[model samples]
Target chain A: MSGAVLLSLAGCALALLGGLFASSPLSARRYRAAAALAAALIVGGVWWVADPRGDFGHPITAEAVDANGAPVSTVLVLQRDGGRRQVRRLPLRRPVDGAEYALWAALLLGLLGGGLQYRTRDVGPRWLAPALPAAGAGAAAVMFARMGGLESGEAGVRAWLARFEVGAVQSFTVPDLPWSAQPEGTVALGVAAAVAALALASALWTTPRSGGERLIPIGAALAAAAVIWRMIEVGGLPWRPAEGALWAVAGLLAVAGLERSSALRASTLVGAALALAAVALGA
Target chain B: MPRLPRMRGPWATAWAVVASPWTPWALGLWVAAGAALGLVSEPGQHPASGLVLQLPAALLVFALVARDLGASTARLRWAALYAAGLATALVGGWLAGGEAGMAEVGGARPTESYTRTIAGRSAAAHLGAQLGATLSADGAALTLAMKEHHVGEAVLPLDGVREAHIGRWALHLVDVAPGDEPAYARLKLTPRGGGDPIERAVRTGSGAALEDGTQIAVLRLSPDFGRALGPAAQIQVDWEGGSATAWHFVDSPDLDARVGAAPWAIELVEVATEPRLVLGVRRDGPIGVALAGFGVMIAALLGLVFAGRREGRS
Candidate 1:
């Protein structure tokens, strides 16, 4: 591992250890203060190590080869940044190749630490409860928007060709299936929209005094179900869920299941564990 | 106390210990350790490859954690039911194996036309006068030769052609040829920040390494490429951290064929038609068990929520 990766791992470890120490019953005022210092160090370390600007401006070339390693189609991707290029490839395969494990580990550890710290400090302002759900809804909305409309792969290609008098008289006829029949991104879009709306509703109603507090768990459960459904829908052949999708569904379900009885901090720990298992299995 | 409950068995005692409050913390540590070890030992390999042995134990630990977190007996029962359903689905699917899901079973041969419309013209004409186009495979490129009744023929390279504006319409290149061949290509590499253009003429199975450490190789070359019958070349370019193989056509100069983000803009200036075979693919899987499990899990969780509400009211 590079120094940056090592630094990142160190920061994550320190954050987790500090957060756990602060949250423990044996922690004193001084220990909590020390933990706070450690948190600051972690933030600084992350800021220093993480590449915020990212690997941009580089050209990317993608080639699809047949079984014999013959080039079927080679695409030269220019002008677009690396991040955008990866997003375009999301539908086909894993966007990140190596070091994905480290990235995920850092993310999980950071979240675990933050959750522990947040619990020790008590639930923040009333508005904070809705913040995460609203962000999730926003993210879902963005994903839906990015995916655009679902198109029949062959039909779309043929339509373009027909204008050129190509494929105009072909004997091959692909049934113009209805929108519901197009499973590509249609199911994912529908589920995303549904979950987004539910999350928005939960964000709006989850408050200490609000009678709609139950909406939190309800929204979480529905999101989990929607994610799981999308996984099954998109998983080709053997029906294996994508690693990212598995982690998401596991975390959402753990939250929905444990949020009623356990404190948010405890639930975070459980969710993290389940998320780990989900990611490992999918990997 | 009235013959007190008979001393519990060894298994019962062990179960009690396993379900104790401290068990979750211990399990959490164990999971963390496992994850850390996996990360350190084998970074990129699938976790299941190395950690499959620990899955059952991990599941048991998860159950303990759930119980310790105060999940009710009813909720636990529901979770157990869902797990059983999932297990049944997996087992049954394994036993009845032969690809249970939907898949594209057939394809059709479609008559495709390639035509160009002149600007400000209402009529669109095919490149060939007789409306006949023949697609021939030469190496890695597919050459589309349109037969013109009036004069010379219009030969278009279909392989490695990205965007070709024939009149007002822009046609994108789709699929190329199958298999590999040595490329015979002429390349132009322009440095991103403006430097001397490096030009090289490479034939099939040969390569040239630049001073800047960029390796260019002619990986595949079409037969009759010099004669311009769908002349094309597949060039492989490798830099420090990345490599890309781009298809180049002799006819189309506007084709942007570069792979990956490299410092140099490598252009391959080197290098078809048929009724496109359109495949109608339908994909299906043995998802019945999984779906059932999901439904059960969701229903059970919702039931738990409602039950809690009812209990609160009482």
Candidate 2:
């Protein structure tokens, strides 16, 4: 079987087992625990397997040639193969939107925060219940709107494969971003950072101290902020505050619901509602 | 002092009603039913756009009502809600669209003058052009032979067809190529009465039976098109001179989707063509949304598991 089919099968199986165990009585506590763990794994596994970048079905890749047996079309090109560094590009298609990457990362953080809050006896900052998701969604929207990928001018996947490159790493280089290297970009980024830091500081204030739990929300907050920064500053994305805020609303609702408590049932239900809302608005 | 029940008034009453085990299932069913309506008109189009809203609404109902359902029965009821929603959606998708797709839309129409070309000077361009052939279907594969002279015919099977058009192309009766018997077979054409066909053009990318440079057009049927046509069914082909020709078919449509629709790549090995549109499946959208949906479901299940774990612990 192809890797995707195997992954899908695994996901379906885990989901099924999880459902069954979820209803089992106290006598089957062991099975329930195992099922829950399996279900958790399914969430991550399915996401990875189904990602647009995952290229789930098509495994066959061939060069399109002309009548003279010369190559005509290609899809993907490897700019650098990693031992020290790796880079790949599709000349025709827009590079993977940085905003998309940010959105997924935010989701990861959301899941992480929810998991972390499970053991806490006391809730973290009441404000965090709303602020975190708002920030996350807003940042995502802003980043997405700014992406070069979404622009009409951006090329498709066919173009990306046109150029093929392979090279050994000579030296690692950090490409300068508009946000970091330029003054205007730096100021805007700094202001956004300050606003985020204030929100996070407030959230962390009331959080319980155990297993370094404080880092969870902070890390999540940072991830969201960083994604926004990367999109605008480095990717040279446009500014659209309203769109950003809308996504922020979605993010806020999502995180608030999921992070409210570690009680699996309640959180899941809440998470589902908020996440769906986010997708509806943003997608 | 004895503590009175910490809740009171209309708010408390609302909570009591929502806490009932059947509420989630009932609500979920309602959502599925409502969403299924959007898919009813045409399943072939895969039109599930309302899913974007319907899914959120169902989830929101659950979220709004989800409270401390401390007992086993309540948890079981919640699981039932998930099952019901899943079942309902599956049924909906199936009814609206065929199996894994959507739309009961329309039937296929005949195509005319579809061509793909490879611009190489000496590239082995293979093409298939057929006329007045009697087809025997072996589930998308056909044992086709010209009725008049038993000329160029091959068993075209699963994934062995490239571009198939249902319109006009003429048969060059005088042009004949002696093809290899086992692998490549020659076709000899004998026209009853027609001058539209150029009797010298050939497309031999893989093993087409006409001479090289014979500009020919043949009816390339859709996957299972021949099978769907039953034995000796007449197929229409518009001739180059505004005339129509009839070809016979055999068998039934292979219900298996792959048999009806082969991967486009499979046809490339057997047939080379001029530039033409190549269609393939390319799914684009946020898979993260699907993941999130599953995540929510699993998390709910985890809650049930935790409940069990806690009960066992206690």
Candidate 3:
């Protein structure tokens, strides 16, 4: 297994544990401590396993050439000294992998919702308050399903190449761009930061409500839609940071205004608009 | 009583101005104008010079957002809802039309998408170098593009191509049209000299004949089958039970034709996005951005309306 896979598994474990303990009858200090632990594990795990070159067997670099044995000018050869034992095959993994991003997304959403956890004035179902975070976590599975097995995409590419070559078989690794280099993740991150900063300023105009109960169904719906959109492969993951959060938060806020909906009309209109924007961006 | 004497300074004026909504509007207009000017300005010597323009756009957005920021319940919910709408529209529209989005490049037909394919074996070595330029789609047309300014274009009108591998990367244009069937297929030669790729009407009838001197690459099938056409012509690619895209490369413009050789065909496959959607998205991106911007502006307006109400009540 690639380190990315291991890291994601570890993150999932820690995050779940933190969520469980943070909401328990424990002291606020303990809750904060568990949350802190989860955050550290997630960050440390991603950093430790971030390198793609870490997966190769015994670092033997070879010259990449064409069928005619001519040197193509697109790439420059780089050598790295391998210090570890060789593995013949391994799973492709990345720290900024869709799955990892989904987990991180969950954490971010949880952080946003944590304000609901502070007891002081009054409280509604705190358990229900995790609706958005839970939805974010569920969205990861949808992303994985949408991305599909790495090999399947490679196979699709390979099959296409077979049409042109004389005796072509799989010769090189499929191009798996490094996580930091992927535009979607990078753009999403920047947008998320900007939006959150904006929210810190303007969100103060809003009020908090105890009706976390209503969000559960909406979150569930989002998770389902995420899977469907990924399955279609048109473009864009349903729960990407900027677009998904925008829609999710809007849905919650709109629903909050009616103390319910004026029916489901208001919520549906905003929800539909947000969904269109998200999907269209992927295209 | 103590503050009464100090309310006369420029500082007080500045405070009053800052608290007014007009401050945000003025700053917003200035920033918007800067962004528009940046778009019109000449490209800077250093690529980062263009950021001089973008900085103002960002500042405008920040100023507008932060100016109205508060901790009140009304502000938070309304703002979050509006901001969400704003973000979606902006990113989505940007993806469709702006520099950030796919730049639509197609010949006369003018589509949001053009099928991307790679041809020739030597294209891969410099795949990394050409990737940026290739992605720009500046020189992109109907044909598959290669490194440098070289282009490898094949016009297979009747026979649909499933995939193609240029030297750069694998690309597939899988159009698994409903009726998948394989019959006789042949592709003409474009002679690799940039004239026109050989053409063949995609026919799905059985029994194909391979004449001598037919230049064919039989990868899955045996080279011995090269000599005998009638019996060895049966080919099935894994993509479908048989081929729907069969072309008889008829007027061979002399492509690697070998003597005493039988011609057998291979299935075409590779990597690429859906051809139709690409064009549509590229075209629609800008429109989406504008519409989204308007939507967000409306929300902000509503927030203002609520703010006005709150002030009146207070």
Candidate 4:
């Protein structure tokens, strides 16, 4: 079996065992300690199996030449398990802009806030709670503006725009603000504004009941929207989600499910299942 | 306050250290120092070094949180799962070799095109040219076909020519002849305006400035003066306060090579290019494992939160 499939199978088994343990009413302290030890050992075993030195995957480098023996290309061949070989194309141009950095910052803030929320007592003053998410959303907005709106000069945006009824024009001209005319940009700006407004309101008016519970998911949703927009702008039409986007969605779903559900075990199972799906899709 | 029984041995010492109020602060400082060092250093030097430094801190924090929250076995199990997932992610990243690094395949040429391979995927540069590369099924062999000779193209907007009624003036490449120098391209330039069309023979790297302040210079001639591939010229048009370069391929006239942010569009047609396909792999870390770890962490954290809430209510 392929490494990803094998890992997934192992994950499924572990998750099932965890679920059974969670549901069982065994009250013996020794039994509980033994289960935890076994779990730790299982995790170590999985890691050992996945080690690169094992038979999972390895890298191979080779050079290619034309009929005249002139070097034309160099190729890096990776041998995956099950002897499956596939040729894939990577994008040559990777445009990094302020929006991408802003999204990353926002993701980090959301995660930090989530971690803080898990603490027994509040880590900081009350105002700091909402301010964190607010700052994240504000940063995203500022960066989006700095990037000359959503439709700056990316080819992906132009190609996506071409699909619309707006003739063969290279770009849409919005006299003063260039990004106002693009639908994606407008929606993204709206989402960012809304998230910021909500966070600000929470900060000034009322204390959040569940701390970062609502804020993290909303911030994640905003980040996810930006990631999806980036995917469209980079990959163009028939866009495929990149690995980063897949992980962002996985994290969002997992956190949201855990926060919303009452039963911890059921929520964990759902989160694990979603994570497995993300892995399968990303792989 | 009632005194508790004094504990001894290695396990007790470890517990005492973990329970110390200064422990989290010290670990936090260590994390901050590592992060600061990582930020000051150049990226890709040791991409995972920062993460590696923070791993021990994370483990300690996890332990402290578990003890503080009085987490049950199930919650501890989930936390272990989360740690395992994170370790797996770290291993995946270590295996992938961190960020992408470029390796020069061959020496530089007059014009070189590049191709990249990421995670077994390949893509050619957007040069309006083609480079063929293939990999064998056995993951053993790869073949690349390089073009020996190819045509080049370029386009120039007439409106930016500076001369009055220049928009009405049409410039055409009448002919390309061989010159004494291999790099020289002898070109016949015909400009049709209100008056009769003026025909002039312009050598490569040299062009005449019209009565207007407009200056045209032939920047480069691709594939030499006269070769199997049709002659391609890199032409620069400089007027009053602005300058633009365009490519003209004698073979392909329809190629739109206009790029950059300018009021008036200049079409740089096509040019001969010897493309070298260089494949580089950018490992964005083990995203799947990291994400799985994140999910497990969230699940474990939720369990702890629920437990804490229940204890508070009681």
True contacts kept of each: 0.11, 0.00, 0.00, 0.00
Q: Where in model 2 is the C-alpha error above 4 Å?
A: A1-50, A53-91, A97-105, A115-124, A149-267, A273-283, B1-314
RMSD of each: 21.3, 22.3, 20.9, 21.6
Residues B1-314, candidate 1: write the lDDT tens digits: 01224447896676566655544444443444454334222121233422432343245434544453345565555545544543443343343222111111111111123322223222323332222223445321122233342322233344322222222222222333231333346677777667888778776777988888988887876633444234467778788988878766543544542333666776665331112311111122344554555466456556656765765686
Per-residue lDDT over A1-283 for candidate 1, one digit per residue giving the tens place of the 0 to 100 score: 1222222222222222322232323222122222222222222222222222222222211222233333222122112332221100001111112222322333333333334334445355533432332343234334423433333445543442343332222222222331211111222222222322332243334322312324333433453455344434333212122322232333333333433333333333333433333223212
How far off is each candidate at the interface, as Cα RMSD in Å? 12.2, 20.5, 19.7, 19.6
Scoring the B chain of model 1 against the true B chain gives a TM-score of 0.33
What are the DockQ scores of the candidates, in order? 0.07, 0.01, 0.01, 0.02
lDDT of 1 at A67: 38
TM-score each candidate: 0.37, 0.26, 0.26, 0.34
Clash totals in order: 36, 48, 49, 23
TM-score of chain A of each: 0.27, 0.29, 0.28, 0.30
Order of models, best lDDT first: 1, 4, 3, 2
**Given the true complex, what DockQ would model 4 score?**
0.02
What's the C-alpha lDDT at position B105 in model 4?
Answer: 26
Query: What C-alpha lDDT, on a 0 to 100 scale, does residue B229 get in candidate 3?
Result: 19
lDDT of 2 by residue, B1-314 (tens): 12225578997876666654444433433342332232222211223333533354445444433433343464545444433433343333223221111101001111111222223121221122222222123312111133363333332222211212211111111111212211211122223232232222123223223332222233332212233221121222223334232332211222211222211101111111222111111111212332333334334444544544455556
Off by over 4 Å in 1: A1-207, A210-220, A235-244, A259-261, A264-266, A269-283, B1-13, B21-285
Candidates in order have lDDT scores of: 0.36, 0.28, 0.30, 0.34
